[model samples]
Target chain A: MSVTGPAGFRAAGVAAGLKASGAPDVALVVNDGPSHAAAAVFTANRVQAAPVLWSRQVVSDGRVDAVVLNCGGANACTGPGGFQDTHATAEHVAGLLGVSATDVAVCSTGLIGERLPMGELLAGASAAATALDAEGGPDAATAIMTTDTVSKQSLVEGDGWSVGGMAKGAGMLAPGLATMLVVLTTDAEVGPEELDSALRGATRVTFDRVDSDGCMSTNDTVLLLASGASGARPDPVAFDDVVRAVCADLAGQLLDDAEGASKTIEVEVVHAATEDDAVEAARAVTRSNLFKCAVHGEDPNWGRVLAAVGTTGAAFAPQDLAVAINGVWVCRDGGVGEDRAEVDMSGRAVTVTVDLGAGTEHATVWTNDLTADYVHENSAYST
Target chain B: MSVTGPAGFRAAGVAAGLKASGAPDVALVVNDGPSHAAAAVFTANRVQAAPVLWSRQVVSDGRVDAVVLNCGGANACTGPGGFQDTHATAEHVAGLLGVSATDVAVCSTGLIGERLPMGELLAGASAAATALDAEGGPDAATAIMTTDTVSKQSLVEGDGWSVGGMAKGAGMLAPGLATMLVVLTTDAEVGPEELDSALRGATRVTFDRVDSDGCMSTNDTVLLLASGASGARPDPVAFDDVVRAVCADLAGQLLDDAEGASKTIEVEVVHAATEDDAVEAARAVTRSNLFKCAVHGEDPNWGRVLAAVGTTGAAFAPQDLAVAINGVWVCRDGGVGEDRAEVDMSGRAVTVTVDLGAGTEHATVWTNDLTADYVHENSAYST
Candidate 1:
């Protein structure tokens, strides 16, 4: 089972002592291809990780040949020493692969403000380089796991081209543009400009819409590396579509795997006067703890839904609003309408619809129901 | 014991059937005045309650002789009918007290979007009026309790001038000007202009610093009515000083009664580049769930404290930051310093200090730690 999305890429995953559990803590993916064109998105949080800083600087030239990722310690808030460690890690990877240090991007996620174990990390990198193979993509995906229960990997094959990607995150996932650590590989011939545009467009609606908890991470990074090995350059428009499809699929996986989550909720805000209003209302519902808890309990509490909507800055008369949960019209014209007891929630997917009765503009956001496990998991960790 | 602090105001509290548990739910305070001058502040949430709307309108003329308060059914999101109920409640109070309708202010809290129980509410209002006496302030304070373990009342008396206030709220309390509902009566002779100025100044630093939870309420209101009954007029500066002290004391009481609150955490952000930066840093700490939980468990997790500060918009070099928990400096110059085990948290008050290393600006915010009870209580009810 080759983890590489394209024909000309090799991948490796290995256990590093950085993780206390001795799980595969390091993953390496390299482009053995016709082009090194790449584009990446980093966390918008002002308090960024050392890897984020290094990767951001590496990708500024629109070229990247490989990416190195490790789990167990997010080298964030470690001050100057952390930044030095990130630079050294990239340099070591570049030296082993015979590539320029600037072409090597790095990513990490785990505990914040913890220093990387340099000896174990370097040893893991060396082993990863020797273990890289064309058929090791699956193992590489599994290596990046932190608290994730399952590996998130998706491959979309088009005519003479393919897009492959992997994602890892269980909490602190709020979509500002990207929410988790993801690496996308493709053999499709595309330029950096096209890749940037496609990634932004895809992430805007997909990864950016899934808000597991409202906390933003300091180490989130999403990088798309094009090997361009197939020499079958598809139309830019078509290539963008494939990129979006891959992102959407991976985003669904992240939401489904949200920590302590029982259901993946889709909140659709339609008939708004403007797209901003639609997005605001959708995001408000997605971030509401009470609304999320009600969903977890399988309770159709439409009154709480209306209250969340009312708190948004969007202008909508309470009387003009309507809401539906799980396809049942539970509220209409701002008051209770249908019998809420009729709605079922035996499945893992739930849908909430809001009709603003303004215009045709619409937006949808993905979220998970709040559960006791969420509180338990978060509160148990002193840090 | 007379609840009036050198003032000649009659107050009373009585049980109304508004609460499901049949507890005392109504309170009235009337200033028997030689001069009736008042100022009021209300919630900034776009979605306003009926009482909030009515009070805002009534206080526009700057004269109010009495205040009517009830807990258990917050007439919010009840649409037009709710607005009518608020008007009727005020009108009834005014009619019974032989005061002008425009001279009365009303406030309600508890479940949102519910209609007032007119029959029980009216009967309770009549009873409260008949029971009103200058020494019934403590009873009035107890009447507005809803899930609160204790009644919050504060009094300040000096040189024949006095200020007395009562407050109610345990959750959904975050500061804009006021989080919960508050009523203040003063015997000092001050015009409406001076009263408004003093109230705003006092609340800016006192009630505005308490953040029990990040949830903003739709029915929060604070009204100050001056009766000039003591026949002693203090200067504007002296009156403002007394008002500030009273507000601070009342704010302390509110924080002590916060829902599921084990300890009151005061976050101080010092040496910020600007006032906004200081405030933003303080708010970031106040809103951090992880930090709150750490404090609850009596763990001095300074790393989480820095992480919380890093999320703020304030500009600062990580290497220039310092943090202290309960007077024990745990991190200095952005690196871990003293052992976190040295900090003691056996008391009910915990303090966190952050030095932004930007300038001399500073700010303080009061918040409660996150406990299992908070999750239990909030998850058990619908907004």
Candidate 2:
């Protein structure tokens, strides 16, 4: 159960022949509710997809009745024609749902700089609208996958309501949102402003912390729709926590399915002068190709960590820095400390902890090891 | 002839037990001069090697008598004890040459976070000093190899003087400097202040633009020593040009020998608002793993280029951008232009030109393609 796990929601997925392989490439989710409060976030990349530009306007009024997403073609860098394609898509979906075109959001994924197969896409959208069911959340999740090995969905229960979400991203995972598409639904009686705040707060620490490849995408988007069907207004703070938990769960699933990744690494920076410093330091380590490769080989090369940190402006003296691989403190006071042989990295998960020895703040960033498979997967063909 | 191509300079490389393979691991270059003038540049990384700290002080007074370089150990992140070792090595070289220790510079390369075998290093320095000859530049160049497949040497002749240099670095190449160690010798009658300015100007475009892997090392150093044997005193501008030419030659050689690289990429950003913006935009493209991988696959995936450009804070509207791969205008006005098949990438050199269409300034950054071989070579070893 994903978006349809909540009340007053229905979804469906259908094949559109957009992909040469004829995979399911179109999905629709409708919010049939007493209240249509919604919020969203998009990629920070300036060169956004046509769907992103269209959806930003659709949710600007804090009201959305439906969402239409398609895979197999990222209508990015497609210029004015692509924007018109998105506008037509929204209009078609709104006509079928008996709603205003301005209340329908659109999303797309696949190769950039290409136009979508409009005829096939429109036909698939009609089929999806006709097949809409309360149990179609799983099918919607499956339709949005590009290179993902598995579909991702999560659900968090509230007192009398619940939050459900699904995410699709396998590579180009980075800050300011991964190359991802996420949709969430909640049946709690919450206002649009609170929903927007909670979504931002949750994504800031969850989705934004996953820096798998340090490549931000032009088509990333996350949307949350709330319907007051449950009539349950739990504590606002508790509602926020549930939303965060759901986002965190989806983020973990995305990491687990990251393309060509054999190990999931958690880089934790402690004793930072500020939270921003901690984040900057951790991101530095996560983005170091040499460090990522060393972790891939389980070499326990802590010096690369220090070198990566040195490149940043975070407040920390070189002499006061320390690093640990797994649970073994391999470097202390910027020099060799315990035996590096004691650290084991044969497992699928690796933890690298850095002690800035500065102040009292910390942050963690998730990433993947650099592998030959990653290089091959990315180079063998164009995505 | 490399460093010893100039008159009044003696250099030698000798084997030291520090290297497990018993290869030539210690080198010495001496400036026997009527006038001793010198300038140097070290890695910008704050967590510098012990030898870098020692060499910065040795060249502080704009005079250097000798430079001692060793491979097989970087002596970085080794704390105060490592500093003491560098000081001792410099003092030993000074004792052999009968010069003040303050005028002797030192450089080290190889694995970091490890102490050098002081006994073997000092003994090797003595042997290098005893074996030094005016024609030993090539041997000194060969001695500084860590993983480099070939020794880098260049010579540029002036009116009555000449500039010659040697460099060694095959990986960890990035902005500020590759993980490189360079020594240049000149017979020009130039002052230390002019030499400093000339060296900075030369490297700012040459070595500083070679960002092979985006990993700045802790032990990068470049030293220029003038003996003033050619008292002709050529035009200052001509001397600076010669230095720049020599640096460019050596930088090209280093790029050719970059570890596990199959293609040398030149990312040139044109029509930028400023030179700095051009550099920032080009560097952003050079550092994109997806773009690099696409180059390795010989795929003219121009979308990756636009995505990379969109990540920078440089001046350019999304719709005004254009990119050409190998002189083929594949993307114009931020969308598809000429057929991508018109671009050819089946060669060792690949040029990606981005037109910001905002102004008139331009800059170029050199980089390497990401390949499975690069991942294997880096991951299979600790260095």
Candidate 3:
């Protein structure tokens, strides 16, 4: 179940001929709602795509009837023409779905600095609208796949209510929302303000902590649509929990399928003076090319981890820092501890824990290993 | 001619048997001074190596009679024992040279988180001091090589004096003085204050701008020893120019031999509102893995350049940014410009220029391509 797993929602994915492989490259998710409440987040990058610029305004009113997404061109750095193409595409989708053009959200992802084929995108939007169904969630998920080897979907059921979402990301993935496209839907009696608060809370902890390759994209978008068909108005705390769960699930999937990654790394920073310190420390480790390469090589090179941790401005005494790889305490008090040979990196999942010996706060960031394949894939798709 | 090319200095490189390969791993450069004025810079990384801690103090008094360098181990993250080892090495050299222990600078390279074999290092230091000669500069340069494919040395003859130096860096190279060990000696009669000011000014532009893999090493050090043997003190301005040129030469050598680098990338960002913004913009492009990979593939993918440039908070209009590859304008006004095929990247040197159209300030950062061999070398050496 993708976005359509939630009641009063329909979705579809179709071949827009935007992709040279003739694969499905256009997706639509619409809400037939008693409450047209929504919230969205876009890439934090200073360089944004035309679709991001258009959808930012679409989400400003906290209402979205439909979202049109594609995986052909980023429509970035195309000057005024790219913006016009995005506006035209939104209007076309809005007309087909009988909704206000201003209420349509758009997201496009692929190569940067290239304008989309407007004619094909409009045609694909029309076909995607025609194929919309309550069970078309999977198809919609499939259409958004770029370098992704698999489609991502997550759903959570509450008492007479449910939440669902679908995400696509494979490269240019980093925190501040990994170069991802996501659409979350919920069927509960929630107001625009409630949905917005829950979305911001959920994504802050989930999407904001997944750094796949340390590259931020120009077209990352995460939109949440609420269709109050379930009549069950969950408490704010409970609603946030469900949204966060779905987001975490989708984020995990994104990390699992991160382009050219051989291992999924979970960096946990503990005993930090503050949560921010923990996050800062963890992000530095995730960004270290040396550490990532060691992870790919299945070597418990905790020295690299310590070196990376030292680079952060987090409050920690070098002599008091400790690191553990897989489950083995490899470095204690910033010096060698357990035998590195004892650590087992035989699995695809790896966990690194750094204890600051400063205080109690902690945080975790998920990332991927750097490998030769990462270079190969990036070299092939750099354009 | 390396450090010893200057008058009143002697140098030597000898096998301390500290390296597993039994190669010459210990080097000593002593200033038999008429004037013992000296200056030095260490890695900006918070997690400094043991030798860096020792040498930083050694130069704090503005007088250094000798420098002891080794390439067998970094002696970092070894806790108190590592610091003690560095101290012992300095003391050994000081006793042999009949100078105070506080006047002997120390430098170490190789793997971190390991302790030096104190006995072997002391023995090597003894042998190195015994082998010190006026023409031993090349041998001292050879001793500092780790994974470096070749030794790097530069010499500049001024009005009545000369400046000579050597450097070694292959990986973990980045600004904040790049991961390298350097030693420079001059016959010019300059005070410690002048030497310090000139050294800082020179390194800030050269060594501090070469970011090979964005990894700041814990063992980076640059030392300048001055002797008044030539009785020639050129104008301070002229002295700084020669020092900067020597540093720029050594920095370029570090980038050229960056571990497994197939291309040396020069990223110049111009028309920024401030010099800091220019440096930030240029460094951001240098750190872009996608852009580096594109350079490796010999693809003039200026879209990656724009994407990388957009990530920086430097003052620039998205529509006014222009990028040129190899002097070919592949992107102008942020729109596709000039055929990408017109940009020839067949050579190893690549130049990517970005015009921000914000002001007149500019900065240049040198980096290397992200190649499979880079991954291989880093992975193999990570532990």
Candidate 4:
């Protein structure tokens, strides 16, 4: 179960002729709710996709009746015609569900700089609406995938309600969101303001901390829909916790399925003057291609880590920095410490700890190692 | 002829057993000057190598008698002992040249975080000093080699004066300098102030614009020693032009020799609000791994180019950005224009031009494509 794990939600996934492999490329999730409260986050990239522009307006009023997503065409950089296509898709979906077009959100993923095949998409949307079921969350999760090898879904139960979500993405993962589409649903009775606040607080630390390849996408989206079908007015703090838990679980799945990644790296920055400084420092190290390659080779090359840290404007003296690979302190006081051979890196998970020795704030960024497969997959993706 | 192409300069190279391959790993360049006016620039990275710390102080007085450079050990992150080793090397070179140790500059490049073998380096310094000759510039250039396949040398002549320089680096090439050491000698009668100004201007547009993999090294040094042997003070503008020409030539060579790169990409950002905006836009494109990989695969994926440009704060509307690969405009007004198939990417030299449509300012940045060999080389370099 994904979005449909919560009550008062129905979802369906249908095969559209958009993807070359004939995989399911269209999904629909409708909120048959007593209350229609929603919140969303879009990609920070100024070159946003057609659907993102359409959906940003749809969710602006803090109410969303439904969300429709498609893979196999990013529909970005397609100009006015692309925007028209996105608008037409939302209108078509709204007509079938007896809702206003302004209440429907649209999301798209895949290659950029191309137009979508509207004929197959509209027919697929009709099929998805007809096949909507309360237990179709997994199918919806599977449909919104581009390079993802597996569907991502998570459910967090509160006192008498639950929060559930689904995510899809592989590459182009970085700060300000990635090439991922996430749809979250909750049965708790919450207002639009509370939903928006909870969603922002959750994603700021979860999806926002995942950096794969440091490539920001033009079609990233995350939406949360709330319905009062559970008749549970849970505490706002508990609701926020459940939302964050679901988001964290989905983010982890995205990292686990990152494109061509052989190792998952967690770059932890500690003892920073501020939380922003810690995040900045951690992100700098996570974005270092040299350091990622070293991790792939299983070499405790702390010099590359320190070099990356030196590139940031964070407050910390170079000589006061210390770094550890796994559990071994490979570098202390900015110099060689423990024997590099003692640090084992054969496992698929690697942790690098950097102590800035500045203050008490800290942050951890999730990333993946750079491999030849990553280069090969991305190089052959569009052409 | 390289550094020794000018008068009043002697250079020598010798094998010091520091390199396991039994290759030459030590070089000595002496300025037997009528006037020893010198200026130098080191890596901007705060975690600099010990030699950079020593050389920064040596060049503070605007005078340097000699420069001794070694390969096979960067002597970085080796604590106070590393600084002591650099000081000792400078002292040994100064003793041989009968000059103050403060006037002797030291440079090192190789694996970081390891102490250098001082015994072998000292002995090699003695050998290099004894073998110094006026025609040994090429030999000295060959000595300071790590992963570089070939030596880089360039000469630019003026009226009865010339500027000659040698450089060594193949990877870790990015803005704020790279993992390179450069020794430049000129027979022009110029003061230290003029030399410093000309060098800064020349390098700002030359070596500083080459970004390969976006990894800044801790051991980057560029030194220019002016010897008034020619007794010819050409126009400062002409002298600056010669220095810039030599630096541009060497920068080109570095791009050509970038590790595992099959294509040399020149990203030109035109019609920017300011020169800084142009440079920032160009550099963002150059540092994009996805764009680099697309170039490596011979794919005219203009979407990646625009995606990179969107990450910058440069003043440009999404609807006004246009990109041209080679001579064909593939994107116009942020949308697809010409057929991408019309843009040929079969050549080793690829040019990507982005028109911001904001102002008249422009800039160009040189970079290399990301490839499997690049990942392989960096992954296995230190292990």
Candidate 5:
């Protein structure tokens, strides 16, 4: 079977005994490339994971040939010892692939502050490298998940090259980007600079807008690798389109699998003074627990929405704002507008639209309604 | 059954049909004195409640003889209509007591935006006025609660005067004073200016430090009424001490009854460059969901705590920070210091200390653990 992205990458996943549940916890990705150009986005959180620190240095040279990812142990807050483990992991992967150590990237997820079980991880990495195959993308996707109920993979097939990626995270999802670990691989002939620009542009609207729970993580990393095997150097605009589609698809999967989520909420803020203001308004409402709870209960509580929006520093006269939920205009000119009973929210997707009546700029943020299951899952999560 | 505070004030509470639960919802406090002075602190949220707007104007005169409180609807975001409801509620109470409406302060809590059921509320106010007695303080406390599992009341008896207060709130609790609605009654013979100074000073360390969830509310208000009923004036220091004690006790109650809260966590930041910096650091960790969840699971996740502190805009070298959880020094000099396996978390109260190693300034913020129950309660709350 052909992998989703480019044509010259092989992937493999295997159980590494890192998770008590015995799920697939190790993945290896290798590029058969003309040029090993890569770009990565690490979590903006100051509390960096050991692997993220290692990967940041490796990607500084703007080239990479392989990525080694392990789930079920986020080697974060483990001090210098954890950094050594990440370095060893990268070195081992580089030796196996016969590449420079700096040409290998590493990622880890799961619990924080725990030392990586290096003995088991090294053995698993060796087994995963031996098991690598051209059609192992799905297995690799499955291996990177923790707490996520399903594997998240997205692909956008283009004329000469394709964009394919996978993401994992169910909670600790919020702006500046969710606590997601993502890897995008493509055979498209794009340089590191172009890839970096495209990835940042794509993520700003897609992954960066999904807030499951208003929490930032200590370990979130998104890496994009361009093998240039297809030898098709598309224009920046076309490359951006592919990146957008892939990011949009992955974001959808993340929301669909949000922890204890019953409904995926799309908050669209339009007619704002600027795109930043629009995004600010939408995100403020998205992070509001009262607003999310109202959505979960199928109550078109426009009052909560207005209250949430009013708290944002965005300048707007109350009478100039309009709000609608599920296509029903529930508030206009900042007061009650139509019958809230007209809203229908008995589905998995819900939409809230706010018109700032200030300017033409707009933004959209995605979130999930707070649910009892979310509480149940998180309250007992650590146990 | 004497009220704890002043000598010439009577208080009463009555049931109103505004709440679906049919709990007490109307409270009345009357000062039978010649001198009446009042001061208030409203929610910092820009989306002010109708009551807050009205009380702000009334308290501007610095003289109020009575405070009428009802818990059924927050009367927030009801637009101009909400302001009218607040006005009419105060007028009704004032008319029944044969006093000017300007001398009466009004407060409301519960769901936001919905108009109060005037027919039931007016009748309840009439009943509360007739039932006013010194022994009705506890009943008045019960009437103001929304989702609060218990009533919060405190008393500080001084040589010449006394301070007593009642507070209510359960969710949307965070710094900038939480979602609290408090009424502090004092018998101290002080001017409105002094009352204001003491109130602000007391709140800065007490109510301002309790952060249950990060969400701020639109209806939080704290009113302090000086009846001057005792006819005995005390020194400023003694009066301030009484105010501080009352506030601290009420703040403790608020944290204990926080929504979905099973344990109260105290985050103390010490040796900071400034008091504001110390408070900021403590509050940052208190508001972190990751840290709260770790505490909920009885996991001494000090790394999450340090990560939270690092994210704050406060300036501090990571290596100069020390962290202790539940009296166990978990990290010192920015790295692991104690055996994680030896720490204890078997109690419902947890204390976390962070030393910045900068100066002597210190601050403590109270918070509650994040649990599944919190998620469960909030997710289904609106329904």
Candidate 6:
């Protein structure tokens, strides 16, 4: 259920004064590795957090000793001082762990465009160092939550190795890696290159497709640390599959707990000209505020779906398109078909299947309904 | 003001049974002209409505004698029968006006994926033909409204000529013409080519930048007709300026009457490297749902603005970007700037200005705030 499920990780969560609510807001994950091989991905947004910039340089060398994550204040858009603050934090951790400062990855979340409480967070980091234990995964996950109602953690058992990860994001979730902060750990004997390849391949089909809010964040980062403490060389293909499974589990959890979302929607586009086309079609529908509202109201308004589809240039004739909501073919051949009244939408999970009838390629994108709660939660307060 | 504000035009509106509520749903504008020069622009969406397809063909020869519009059912995604419906409507109008069918332009709006009530609409068309009058502009404007709270009209006077137009749209309003149906007329002496250039120039800075809700329509159409009745061939530059002014007025009206909107936001991007860059930057901020809701709550969350700007490739360093809300520079040099609390946002109109600090080019985009009423109105029933 957590990154510590792997053999070579030690984690801790500590309450830092960085958060106004006085909740646990600092997390530390240490790879006490026999091998400190690592790979990572950062947010594609050009307006990145200071910590993301710091960690990008660390992971560039495919080696890391520790990761310090803080919530309550995103160290983003703070100019040069923010980057220096991140450097100081990493330097403090490097001092205690007796490792090079450049090997420590720093991650932060919460309100963007503000500086972190450097003094308080640094003190919390020192406390987390002494608090690290194998059972600290749950606490670590909790420390990284912003508006998330629950902590997200996943563990995948492999033949002779194991992969586990934790993610934190409740809003501003659109692909380029799920718009969140994630930390993954494994006990497999793998090189940094293999880990990078496997991580990218896994995320391409998993985290990269979860588009909850169509808004990307400034501090999204995913790190994979391979400690090789299990002393087992798992098959690369098998290891990649396990990593993907863990990522998928965490991605679904992110969507299920999306900010103020009541229903989790799965948009599947089939028979497209290419996988890219299928993704384009699915994303277009997911981004339609009108369609999202219709889904929220439990109205099988296939018309909104068609309007969204029409906005995309995916290779398909409008006349040949079909849309099925919750297994009811509400629109077929681009026209009304089954009685929409027959579709029941009382459940928390809903599926919209669009048949492009163009080619064989297909893809599925996950999203959430646009609810009044979403508007209220987003508008009533600043996160 | 409406199409008949131009001397050579006659207009009418009639209630049709096409709308479930029995609202006026049919409008006609005829050019009783010495000339029939016309220009039109349809939605760029590939999955166009049947009427859009039919009208695109009619306007290609650069002449149109009449325009018929209905706002009860969007003849979109209804397949071949929908095309036939638009064609029959055009032919019916052509016979009554003593013009070729190819010279009639048709427009439709309302719920998508449903067939129009051909029988009732045709009957309404006959009634509207008989009801035609020089004083029928306001009635015509009222007939072509869907969820719009008020009719949008604008009039611009030239030396001896005048331009008047009406627009209808409340949702599914995005670029590519704001998902609207509009008919514009001028008594100025001008040919089709000049009319096309002026129309395109006008709309590019007007309707193309009105991105309320960011859902492009499949049935958006705008027509500009010249009757040559005033016999005043004003300077081309002056005509272009007048056309742009009228378009800006109509675009503003559309924003004011947007469905369920509580605020009309004007986003102006300044000091960009190019006009295109300014537009891209402005549009990025307007599309951010988080920022829209913040504006709804009047939180003055300028961090969201910086986050949105960071997503674009516009030429400006993160540290060089500045954002102002309602004349208060809330974010300067990408960091916290003036006191956000100093800004007043109690009014229905709000303005956000971003300084890219790249060059002198600038552009402005208009949008509406996301509100609970919007979700309720769009979700409670399909339109």
DockQ per model, Cα: 0.34, 0.75, 0.69, 0.82, 0.48, 0.69
Model 5 misses residue B355 by how many Å? 3.4
Give the winner by DockQ: 1 or 3: 3
Off by over 4 Å in 4: none
Highest lDDT scorer: 4
Ranking by lDDT: 4, 2, 6, 3, 5, 1
Candidate lDDT scores, in order, read: 0.83, 0.92, 0.90, 0.93, 0.84, 0.91
For candidate 2, what's the TM-score of chain A, rounded to 2 decimals? 0.99
Q: Could you give candidate 2's per-residue lDDT for residues B96-209 as a string of tens digits? A: 999999999999998889899999999999999999999999999999988899999988899989999999999899888968999999999888999999999999999999
Candidate 1 lDDT at B306 equals 75
How many Å off is the CA of A100 in candidate 5? 0.2
Residue B349, model 4: Cα distance from true site in angstroms: 0.6
Ranking by TM-score: 4, 2, 3, 6, 5, 1
Clashing pairs in 1: A3-A137
Q: What lDDT tens digits, residue by residue, belong to model 6 across residues A121-177?
A: 999999999999998899999988888999999999998889999999988888786
Superior candidate under lDDT, 2 versus 4: 4
Model 6 has a DockQ score of 0.69
For model 3, residues A262-349, the per-residue Cα lDDT tens digits are 8999999999999999999999999888889889889898878887887889999888989999989999988989988899998999
Quote the B-chain TM-score, candidate 6: 0.99
Interface quality of candidate 3 as DockQ? 0.69
Encode model 4's per-residue lDDT on A1-383: one tens digit a residue.
69999999999999988999999999999999998999999988888899999999999999999999999889999999999999999999999999999999999998788899999999999999999999999999999888899999999899999999999988888888999999999999999999999999999999999998898888899999998889999899999999999999999899999999999899999999999999998998898889989998998899999999988889998889999999899999989989999999999899999999999999999999999988898778888
Name the docking class for model 3: medium
Residue B17, candidate 5: C-alpha displacement in angstroms: 2.5
- Which candidate would rank higher by TM-score, 5 or 6? 6
Superior candidate under DockQ, 2 versus 5 = 2
- TM-score each candidate: 0.94, 0.99, 0.98, 0.99, 0.95, 0.98
Flag regions of model 5 displaced more than 4 Å.
Answer: A1-4, B1-4, B319-321, B333-335, B357-359
Q: C-alpha displacement of A72 in model 5, angstroms?
A: 2.5
List, residue by residue over B162-192, the lDDT tens digit for candidate 5: 8899999887876666568898888878899
Residue pair clashes in candidate 2: none
